[model samples]
Target: MKQIVTHADPDLDAIVSAWIAQDFLFQAHASEVLFVSRKVPEKFMQSADCLVDVGNRYEPENYRFDHKPPAFENRNSTCATRLIWEYLLDIGVAVRHLEGLVEITYQGDTHRNSEALKQSRIDGPHAKLKQLKAEYKDPTEIYQQMAFWLRSYTKNL
Candidate 1:
């Protein structure tokens, strides 16, 4: 396997990486691609292989930011995560069964600068897990729910 790291804003990086991963899967004719990240963009759900949330806490440093629930119409972060998981599962990717943490290393060292170091700290996957747990009795059930949804969505596609 080959890895290509690029310098881009967080959101852009997520999109580009997801896209590249999708292309890799197509080129390699792989069953699925696993996307490991602390936070994944909403737009990448269409092409993701597996959306893995490695961090035990969603935003360890910024829990306050995610404490408040968004409006009913607003997107729920955990739901978004489940959506990607479901999308992949529908296409026959056994993502939920996979066990491991996803790690992403930044391309350059920014710790030398205090401001850069501060900017580097952001939320992790744990936040999404917490939110999902609050909504569902068992977080593991999300996998079944996602699989069901995937089954429905892929029928037409």
Candidate 2:
């Protein structure tokens, strides 16, 4: 199985991004897209092709931002959500329907620069994970109501 992996205790961005990636993979990869939200088990990382996130604690080349220029890192302090959305857009996924979701959550990234987010207070409680549960009304319902908002260019990613 191919893996769409996120950092340990994945936050909102990581979880949402992983779900989006899974949807995109369904359009391409034939096998199941395993959403690895914690440190990837060795079996998956070693046996499967892995796509990882900014907080990826895994040491692997599939990492998307390992060699980002220092300036870029400074400007965009967090990864996962923003990176995933941009990657989806770049790869031609239908994420034109989800841009707003990406931006609203990015604010949490700035908060991450200074504080330690916790589940009760996690690392990126916004960027990092605290628990796994549904936080939206319903994705299908959301898409129906806000597809236009996401498609519009309020600001650049």
Candidate 3:
């Protein structure tokens, strides 16, 4: 089974990146998602099939996607979600249905002040994410719920 690792108490980017990996990258294959600390443990670093948003590394060929400093300092407008999404497209995966999802994720990660973002902050996915964070202490539960929501969301987009 493929093992995907991301940060615990995952934010939008981390959850969405992992979701993309599970739903697209590993489609038709069994996979497990693990949530770790911001400083990913060396165990996961060595054993995880994919590391997203928390590895501090951005080597797509290696399936390690992160936009943190030291490795991706110039990727100010991109986040882990965008990297994984682009990787899917590069690998010939169909993700045209996800363009809006990816764009909103990028906007949120980069803190772009747009009317849509502002409205989302008020009562959209962003608001739902915040509500989920406040309600659930378990990261896995949060990811599961968000993954379900994202699956439904993309079908509509």
* Strongest candidate by lDDT: 3
TM-score result, candidate 3: 0.94
C-alpha lDDT values of all predictions = 0.30, 0.45, 0.87
Backbone clashes counted, model 2: 11
Residue-wise lDDT of candidate 2 within 5-87, one digit each (tens)?
54543445555555555555344664333444354566655565544453333333343421123415453465565665676
| Per-residue lDDT of model 3, residues 41-127, tens digit only | 899999999998888898999999999886687656589999999999998999878877777778998877678777767876788
In model 3, residue pairs whose N, Cα or C atoms come closer than 3 Å (at least 3 residues apart or on different chains), thus clashing, are: none
Which candidate do you rate higher for TM-score, 1 or 3?
A: 3
Per-model TM against the reference: 0.25, 0.50, 0.94
Task: Please report the candidate that would top TM-score against the real structure.
Answer: 3
Clashes of each: 6, 11, 0
List the candidate 1 regions with Cα displacement exceeding 4 Å.
Answer: 1-8, 11-72, 77-81, 98-157
